[model samples]
Structure formats: structure tokens, C-alpha cells
Target: MCNAEIDPKTVPHMRELMAGLPTNWGKWGPDDEIGCLNYLTQAEVLRGVASIRSGKTFTLQVQMGNPKGDPVWPGRRGAQRINLMDKGDFICGNGPQTPGCHEFADDLMIMYLQGSTQYDALGHVWYDDHIYNGFDAKSTAGGMQKASVLPIAERGVVGRGILIDMARHRGKDVLDRGETFNHHDLIDAAKAQGIEIEKRDILLVRTGWIGSFYRRDPAEFYTDFVEPGLTFSRELVDWFKEMEIPNLVTDTIANEVTLEPETGVMIPLHCALMRNLGVAFTEIAALDALAADCAQDAQWSFLYTAAPLKVVNGSGAPVNPLVIK
Candidate 1:
């Protein structure tokens, strides 16, 4: 979400100002795929690992299939499907078990590459004809030739994760759909949590919308739920760059409140972070459990690791991110 209530004038003016957007485009080199992941240095990883105390782990991905109804994203396939395989299947499965072996069960999962918790590849977003580093969008016509998920999947991301529970800070069960959190909101929330966000840390914002939607009422969840997410401002963009955060995960799709388009770029956060800043982002994560745990335990930070599927030219993939303390 571009600053809540961006003047219609600002919308039209954004294009001309686009040249000034923050970018790590050439900073990571000409052949950079895993953009900000470079921030996950050896020292940072070791520090994150050292931070672990309780050794309890949390699953950051929501179930692949959710709500038990229509697909979350209309354009893409829905959820996960399991099909009993007869040896060779189009998509590989763990199944086609030994014949007559009831004790052993094997089946293949027809996974929707990105149905639930997932990261956005650096090549995922584009503005008109260009992508990150000013690469022609057509150059990645059939597949992501630049900034594919391959490098991220191979290298993996392990670092400190800081959570900003916006809902609790806001003193509400959840931020209503179309509600937004901006730079000041984040700073204020962090202050309330009594924690400081650090460099190379994975940032996770808990809007509480996901918990409200799934646990309370799916109807209310989908209805008028434009999306309660982050609102991006110039300052927020600069913060991402300044903090050097590698991955930004949120509990909603788009990671920004879905706004009614008045003009150019619809998902401005994606364009700015993915294309210009080369910062990877994950969406639709399950944070309720972790949020509750954080509140009760008063431990908001933890060691984090997210390894996306190593699909050759995958733009992004559904993943099970693990957070341990």
C-alpha cells in the first residue's frame, strides 16, 4: 500500500519519480539472483544461531489448502492435492509404494507452487517493460532468466527474525481489511515491543487478519477484505534499504493493503522492494501461533530459515519456513 490516502496527484506523479526508487540492482553485481539474501552473512547466521535458547520451533507456513472452499487466488490453482500414483506420475510423489504393503503408504502431492506461504522472486515483479536492474521483461518471457528462485533455494536463508505484532500494538483483534501499517506504525510498534530491529534480520509483521479470518469466520474474512497489510511510503522503502532486511514476510497477500487502483503500478510495494530494492518477500504466512507464543513468552525474535523449492526457473514457490528459539 502506498501511503494510505496518497493523493490522486501522487499516483500520476509516481511514474516520473520512479527513477529515484531505492535499488540494489547493480550493487549485488550484474548476475544477482538472490538479491538481499547477500545480507545473510556468515557472522549474521552464526549470531542468529547463537540467539536460540529454548530450542522450540515454529512453522511459519499455513496449510497449503485453506478455508475448504474457493481458491485464495483466483488466477492460480488452489491449495494442494494428493493423488495415489501408479509408479511414474507427471509430478513426482513419495507414493507408488510396494505392492500389497498396507504398512507403507506413498502418494504424490500436486502442489500449487505458490498457494499459501511463499516468497516473491526478485524476477517476480515488473513495471511495464522492465524488471530489476533494468532488464527487459521479455528477456524473461517463458521463465525467469534473471533473479530466479534457484539461487535462494540452494543457499537458504537463516538469520534473526523480528516480529512486529501490529494488531497487539494497535490494541485490536485485527486490523480490518484495507487497513494499513506504515513506517511510523512500525517504529511505534517496535518501541512498544521494546525490541530493536537489526540488520540482516528477517522481518515479520503480524496483522492478525489471518488468525481472525481462519479462526473466526471465513465469510467475514473474504467479504470486504481488501487486505489489511503494510502501506509503503518513501521512508518505509528507505528503512528496508537502511536496515538491509533480506526477507519481509507478512500474514496477508501482497504484503500491503490491496488498494483500489487510480492509475499505474497496482502493488507498489512489490515493484519497489522486488524490482528496485531486490528484497525478497514472503506472504500469507501463519503467525497466530508464533504471535501468541511471543506474547506469552515475551520472546519476539528467533532464528529463521526459509528454503523455497529449487525449481529451475521458478519465480516463487510455496514454502514451509521454520522459526526456532
Candidate 2:
């Protein structure tokens, strides 16, 4: 599956990266949404659960239709509308039989599943027609019979969450949309915080872009500064696999540098990590509060769980990741 047209040396990681790209297709078998989640074994989950000493929880999800999110993609019109069930509807009707003693309230949201903070499923990204575990797109469409979000929901994704506070390292509230972070920076940040990259750990990078772009102003976030993100590099993915990290949570739009060094590859890391390797990415996470709490106590990690809606053949869904310490 190597692309021989381009010289291997031309790319950052060389031929080794190319060869590694197409692997893990059937590593866990033909039918598997388990993917890297397999790394988060019972033992790993138990450890994470046990770490919840104080029972303090922080929400990592940005609200639906949050001003911070960009309505750029088609069908991503933020939230169209929200409404509550009228008092005299199906239950009460025009003659309100039980109106005097009626008690009912309901609310609804017309939103894109991936609009706010969300967990992307294996089928969410693809290399041409194939997805993770070598599932062909046509036969394996998501929702029920494919690489759906169901598997992730069933797994009850709980693990140790490690926050690489890039903002704290730089003494800033948020990283500019133009700044880029590399593998070395990830390591340095971890070492500085006295946290070890461990198997099944959920890696969260606080770029601080959430505060600047989404929280402060929407117009400026979309039109202003170049988005600061991950420097395009295969080494980053390699390190993730080495550490057996299954989930990646980031407080940024795309997670990777908007304009990577390689001009053509808009988000090369996405294809490798999600489509090929089956690593789940939780994006647009509002992590400022969590980062501040972690920094305050010099705590770099927490026990966390990200449970997505059980959409049968869903490619992705909004998630409210809970972090407890």
C-alpha cells in the first residue's frame, strides 16, 4: 500500500511512515469497531475509576450551538432551533383532560451531531473507500451494520485523561490560531508536569484557542489569525501508538495545524490516525476550565469518560466528556 510516486525521503517520516499507514486493517479482525479502544482494557478502566478520589467532575463538552463553533461546513448550521413541548399538545390536547393536574416538560434541539464537542467514529474518516479494519465504505456504511458509533458507546470509554497544557506552558490563556505544536513540545510539556504517557491514556491538548476564537468572538475566530494546531508529522501518531493511547481530545477546531508543512495534505494526520489506525478524536472540546483546575493543583491527569449517543450507524456524535479527579 506504499505510494511509490513520491520519494519516501521527501516526507517527514520517510518510507517507514508510508509502510505503517496501511496497517491495522484486520489486526483486530474484519468486523471490529473496538479498534484502539481495545487498549482501554478492564484493568485500565479500573485504574481510571479508582482515581476518582474527590469525585469532582469537569465538563469537557462545549454547549450545542455554542458561539465558539464555526458554521462553515454544509449542514453545520449550528443549531437551527430549540423548542419545548407545548402544554396542550399530544398529552393534554385542546381540551386539557389532565391540565389542572398535568405535569410534563420536554425540549428538543435541531443540531448537527458533530456540531459541538463530539467523538468521531471510525467511519467518520476514510482513505478513499476503505475505513478502519479494512471495511469497504459501500458495505460498511455507519448507523447499524457498519463502523458505527455503537461500538464506542457500548465500550463505556473510561480512562486516565492526561492534559498537555500548552497554554500553561506558554503562560497564555489561549494559543493563537496560527501557532503549531510538535512532538517534542508534547514530550517537554509532559515531563514538565510530571506525568507519564501511559497505555490507554486519553491525551488532551489544551491549545487555548477555545478562549480566543470561540469564546471571545466568532467573527474574529473564523476570519482572523491562522489556526494554531499540530505540526503535521507522522512522528506524533507513532508516539500515540507507542504509548497505546486510544482517545485524543483537543481544544481546537481540527486538532492538527490548519496549514501543515506539506501543502497538499490538509490534515494528513486525520487519515492516518482515524481512518487507518482507528484512533478516536474528540474535537472542539471546551477545556479552559479543566486546564485551569489542573494547573492550579499541578495535576496533569484525571479519570474521565466520554460517552457518545448510541446512534446505530452514526459516523460521529456529540459527547459530554466527564473528567473527575
Score residue 274 of candidate 1 by CA lDDT. 76
**Candidate 2 — which residues are off by over 4 angstroms?**
1-22, 66-75, 84-96, 140-144, 224-226
Candidate 2 local lDDT, 1-325, one digit each (tens): 4463555455443323345444556778878876888888778888888777667789988766554454333335776555466665655564345647665656777877777788877777665567777777675532436777778987768888889989888777777657888868987988988887667788899988765554565565667435677775667777766777788889876777765666434566677777777788888888899888887887777798989888777777788999999
Given candidate 2, what's the lDDT at residue 227? 64
Q: Please list the C-alpha lDDT of all candidates, in the order they appear.
A: 0.77, 0.73
- Error in Å for residue 89 of model 1: 17
Cα miss at 295, model 1 (Å)?
A: 0.7
User: In model 2, how large is the Cα lDDT of residue 325?
Assistant: 90
The residue-by-residue lDDT of candidate 1 on 8-89, one tens digit each, is 6656544554557678878878877788889999988987898788999999887765545322543555565564554454
lDDT of 2: 0.73
Q: Which model scores highest in TM-score?
A: 1
